[model samples]
Target: MALYGKLETEVEIKASAEKFHEILHQKLHHISNASSDKIKSCELHEGEWGKVGSILYFTYVHDGKVSVAKDLIEAVDEENNSFTWKVLEGDILEHYKSFRIRVKSIPKDEGSVIHFTLEYEKLHEGIPDSHSLLQLCADISKDIEAYLMGNNNEGSFIAKA
Candidate 1:
């Protein structure tokens, strides 16, 4: 028996959805260049980049601590510009029995709305809810949004709650 939860967040950015989606599909490992303050690096550990079931190893600075995760690319939808990754090993597993992250972007006339979704199952009844983790993700999405929009030095792009 498993208990699950899902969280979704979206932010508007002045970047092409198609281009950003393509970068995710083909060059996810390059994220450190654009967002070095958060992500230290990402590498393909198994299988090929942009391929379903491929494994990715990520080293990221989360809340001032370095955390590592090995994740599997679970799904990819090119037309919708979305992909999902299932966590294999990481700090997230310390509290969650299972975890996944999904990302996508929808185009708008003025800009694009980038979306990020998280799905997870608690390790046990005493483990507590995931509100903080979800909030962290939403914040990171805004950072990524700001970076991609060429607003690197501006704090104006932070999504308003």
Candidate 2:
């Protein structure tokens, strides 16, 4: 049997939903660090940006190793300011049965709130809790906020793409 868990974190951004979502998709390589070492590259595999069924190919490293996987865009709702992706093929599949990320926006004055959620199913008991992964997502969110707010000196996992 597999264990399923989810973690979420919210980051306040001094930007609009459209701006945030666009940057998240186009510049993910810049904000992700905790997983950056694992990810060598990412490219659009199919569909349009932020569209359902859009695919992304990711080359990543695990345990000092590198591998690649293709992910499917499961959902994209611009009105709700949310998007989700499911890992269809990748090295992560060995330990994670499935992985998904969802981002939502909350309206606020001057700034907006970006809520990030990660869900996964562990293949075995040896898998660590999702805490680190959640933290990684949070870090990415913060980096994105800082970049949008003109504070580009924030720490990041990957260089600008």
Candidate 3:
């Protein structure tokens, strides 16, 4: 088994790609309010939002358990509509040597694809890939799309007059 692994999930979203990118890149603190059950709070510790070297402390629930994670904003590319964060401290470190999450918005003619990627170097080969974590990320992406489109549900956003 390999010591390193990568997991990905892609979902098409009706919400504006720019809006979605803004939330992840600059307005992550509001995520907890949008989905209080999954993410309790996301607070900045260092640097500015959408800037490199910023530290974010996240209180969240995953896999039926609550945990805290401190992550560093590794990269923010507005041109690509992407954000990358590397885990610095927290429960995730206990399982992996290194872990990072990157989200990119790929625009199409009509809607855009919200792509989530998890790259990790495990503490050992016995550990499985971060599939569950990827699923968690996908679910959160859906929640964000729902909140932005004012749908309040996972079903596709139907425009209102």
lDDT tens readout by residue for model 2, 1-161:
44887888887767666667766664554434323444567788787655678888877554546677788889877677778888898877887888887888776877688888889998887887567656655665665566665665554333333
Worst 10 residues of 2 by lDDT: 29-38
A best-first ranking of the candidates according to their lDDT comes to 3, 1, 2
* TM-score (C-alpha) between model 1 and the true structure: 0.84
TM-score of each: 0.84, 0.74, 0.92
Task: Give lDDT: candidate 3, residue 100.
Answer: 98
Clashes of 3: 0
Against the unseen true structure, what C-alpha lDDT does each candidate score?
Answer: 0.78, 0.69, 0.86
> Which tens-of-lDDT digit does each residue in 5-98 have in candidate 3?
8888898888778888888788888887567789999999999877999999999998899999999999888999998999999998888999
Give the top-scoring candidate (TM-score).
Answer: 3
User: In every candidate, how many clashes are there?
Assistant: 0, 3, 0
Model 2 stretches with alpha carbons more than 4 Å out = 25-40, 60-69, 152-161
Pairs clashing within candidate 2? 33-157, 38-60, 38-61
Model 3 segments beyond 4 Å from truth?
152-161
Model 3 is weakest, by summed lDDT over 10 consecutive residues, at 152-161
Where model 1 places Cα greater than 4 Å from the true spot, the runs are: 151-161
lDDT of 1 by residue, 93-119 (tens): 998999988988898997788888888
